[model samples]
Target: MMRREATGEAAPRTPQAGAGPVPAPLVASAVLGGAALLVWPAVFNGYPLVFSDTGGFLHQTLGPLMLWDKPWIYGPLLHAFHWRVTLWAPLAAQALLVSHLLWLAQRALRGTAAPAAHLGLCAALAAASTAPFTVALLMPDLFAPAILLALFLLGPAREAMTGPEAWYLGTVATLGIAAHLAHLPLALALACMAFLLGLPRGRALRDGARTAAPLLAAIVLLLATNWAGHGRPALSPHGATFMLARLQADGPAAAVIRARCPEAGWYLCAFADRLPMDANDFLWASDSPVNRDAEGRARFLGGALIAPEAQAIVAATIAEHPLAVATAVLRNALRQLVTAGIGDTLGDDHLRTALRPRIAEGFPARERAAYDAARQPRGVLREAMMPLAPLHGAALLLSLPLLAAGGLRAWRAGDAVALTFLAMVLAGALANAVATGGLSGVFPRYQARIAWLLPAAAILLLMPRRRS
Candidate 1:
């Protein structure tokens, strides 16, 4: 009574006549049900899918370091999440993050949703699509779309968010963008595109800064991490080298090399006489001059002399063959969107031969047994999902128009939340496609990482708003 009098506050009221609090058993059931839904893929497959690149990631932290051609944060994050070789912890953490992002997205456009609704939609998504597969896999692909999703929340739907919610969204968005080097540029591109489209006219810029700040922090974190781990002062030095590969496949870079090789004492000049015909051949074949097994690759990556030369060659070739280069980039982007296959590179012999021993040194025996018994020894992605590929392709093709229609409807009605989400997702998909397909070359996994959004946008577009 004295405490109540001091604060002038009333005692809490009980839930009314017959209604008590929610049952603990029901809450537990809901949680368990949600987990089962999200990780059902892992259960269906008996274990998480391990891609060919999984070993490269595992090796970075569990074994000897490898000079992976991509970003390095993914490996250390795995080690941190591995929880002393429990093995399943990382994927569990990924699932949690994915679920959280889905929750945020459910509310992205001032769209109100109960916790049950968010869980149910995620459950539906996990069962119907490849989205959950990424969460359970060891690859960085999931983070790509996750980044875009977070950016959509932070950039456009920020007005609908609380102060703490903004901070959470910003942190997750940064981590997601920094998960892959490709994502780094993709985030900036999306932001720039949004600005250009005049979507961020008012408080959009101020709130969008919330998105930008985290990406900036992530870049700094990357440069510092690379410095500590790989002695590099910048993001991956493989960009020019990768562009060289693309140009080599385009035919003009090789032609230019042949013309310049006679007097150039470059190692590539020596191989001009026996040049490989395509990007994969030039970059990965045992006979390629730039194969990691070959001296050319080491020399090129070793900060010696080849990278700058490759950059020069790429620029010169582009100057000479702009049309061909542009054509290749366009073709690759188009092909990426339609590419339906997923997880084709689920295993590699190199991981077993060179990486597994190191894992054994630190990997717990129990988890090792579990891994081998389930995900290991190689298996193909089921052909059943193959039919769903066309649907994925068609949804992506339709995302933009859905966003435009929704945005227009919201604009006429003055719903900032709907307008923001529509514009942001539309911008994000286009940017993601350009960064992955345009830079990394056409790969199904790259495009599929964000294709779920096409359907998601379509769903959001059709959602009826609350009456004012």
Candidate 2:
């Protein structure tokens, strides 16, 4: 075990082998109780929260149609859990995954595998951070943080984990990365960092390769699913369309269009006058060029239809205005770092239009009724969550200094565990910000989903070190 802190904190005594084993019922109860607390927001909201994008996930399997916008893995997972009976099943699954990972994280970090301590960690996170809110939502956003936690377990916390536990975390990390397109780069960045940090030791190469294995598997799984569903073996077929909107919102695409239009004869030149619109508006607005034909007629799957052009536009814009693109990306990433809030997760008003029809079409009558009666759809969840925004803000604000102190202490003490934990939390958050904010445009939920790790790391850092 690493050296304990010299703060006069007594080291916890290790349990004797094969002695005082926890009863089976107690372990089950601990997991259930912890999961329940982690998903309290859904219980409070009277339903699992839904997003405008939830319909896209549902469509992947429920519609049996390929969505150009995202990967197809989450759709089948949602189907397996819910089976169209109730959305609660999937929420429960998410909660359980989160709960177990938290248990593992607490056990690995503080060297205390007690159920009560695990529940306490969950309770603290549920009260002060965005864990419950993310878990409650039926979106893939929760997996972003889950992936980071899972990576930490497989990397820094690997020494403390048993074989089965390592496999479980590796599986969770793989699924989490495959669940979202943005997650791939985030995981790769962290895994690469781990490799770089481990350079001094011969085992570093082995450890880095082990950590990266899941990412490689996730890529294969993503491609296989995409091939099965869309007949195209690609990560995201319409990614360029989204990128074009982001660049358009950020100014580079507009500058390129204005400078190269007419003579360039790009399809977007028709709308050069409206080049730099909000990313969301560019993608979803009725009158937006991407959503309309040259004659101003509405088109289904218009984004996908224009993806080739979108890709060209994105490439040209990046090439033509490299400095502007970099500046915009940096600006967006910084904005996203501090933009963590429960903005639209609790609110249903903005999503009702696109979300309602999917529920009507994909679910049974009883499930539809449940959706209609949920606090989110009735505009109550956001109001109930309004007070929590400040709490989350304060928690994150306090975590910054704690993490800085912890990082400094870890560096001075040459503590690999503390350093790896700090690095994963901070780097994952920043990489997420850059991936989602810079490429997809800034949304609070993008960062909010992962921001809980800040407080989680801070709490773990403060705990006295003990042998596992």
Candidate 3:
């Protein structure tokens, strides 16, 4: 047992050893409630949620070789449940993760919230925020918020946790951090930001390192997994390329390429005239000469040729065009902060182009029918829910001030629990914007994926007190 600032007595850590199992009726209620929130996207989509990268993840499921574009560990987990084409297996697993996250949030607050209140908050998030969107979405996007929640459990709840609870938080932190490559940096940034912004002043730096322990473990896990799966004991090798694409988006990479290309022996020099303005199109679009040509690919091989050159260009360009670089990064981060990038994400037809052949050989026939009916390439689909995006945007905007106010209030009241919630959510959102937008490029999916945390934390702080 451990004491908090508000409660001098040791708090309940876990259930007593002799306590009976959770009530069946309570379990049923949770399932029913969870189903209500988790099924909204599937119901609306006419099938399970699918993103553009979902098929790539599906294709990489236990692939013979490792792919750095997507982290290695996530694919195997996705592959494990590929026996069903309906994807119910994976979706259920993800919903369970979300449930555990919500449970942790309530627990981190020392059971301040009642079950109904928790469910109500969940419903609000699903209806008016990005919570269900990422949960139902097939990508590892949900892990961003999951990591922050796990950090809360590890940080503020550090002393009070039972052995099993500690292990659970540690595991969640590791998986949530490792599941997505971008999350690795996001977790590191959040751990530091929370320690500085939320933790008590005594030995703050030391405590910050302790707060980041799980993230370190996750980094090691990713390296080990990549070694076992990809033959390289390292994080994703795509950082340099990602950085390159980012420079392209800002107009500096092109200048560097043109200035030093044929003379300096850089490969991108040949395609200097044809580079696309968009980072994504430059990297992934088939028509772009970068993807179409051999030299472009060769330049990026092991970052041996292109990575160093990209670094040099970025440095020199930053030296010459510091304002431009900062302006681009800030603009992209702001773009991610406000507008949700739904259109550029989410897969419907092109997924089938990559998925149908694979599933035909292995997927169950019944699932194939559902997949065809719901996901196969079609001529024209209806418009997006025009109101939902802005409604979510507005909800997020409202949460910004609420979190700010909550943080100040918590510090004044000496509420470590409340401060932890605020720190994790706010730091996660800011780090997400910087890492996802600044490192890669500003994409809607990046912001929308983690935007739910702000509102979730605000609701947790502002909810009416439950009856004792």
Give the per-residue lDDT digits (tens) of candidate 3, residues 244-323.
77877788777777777788776667778765378887666665544555544432334333455566667777787778
Off by over 4 Å in 3: 1-28, 84-86, 110-113, 197-207, 294-324, 346-349, 375-384, 465-468
TM-score between model 2 and native = 0.93
C-alpha TM-scores of all predictions: 0.83, 0.93, 0.86
- Each model's lDDT comes to 0.64, 0.81, 0.67
- Leading candidate by lDDT: 2
Clashing pairs counted in every model? 0, 0, 1
Predictions: Cα RMSD each: 7.7, 3.4, 3.9
Error of 2 at 211 (Å): 1.7
> Which one is best on TM-score?
2
Across 11-50, the per-residue lDDT of candidate 2 in tens digits comes to 3223322112556576667778989998888888778988
Q: Name the candidate, 1 or 3, with the larger TM-score value.
A: 3
Worst 10 residues of 3 by lDDT: 11-20
Between prediction 1 and prediction 3, the one with superior lDDT is 3
Q: Rank the candidates by TM-score, best first.
A: 2, 3, 1
Which should have the higher lDDT, number 2 or number 3? 2
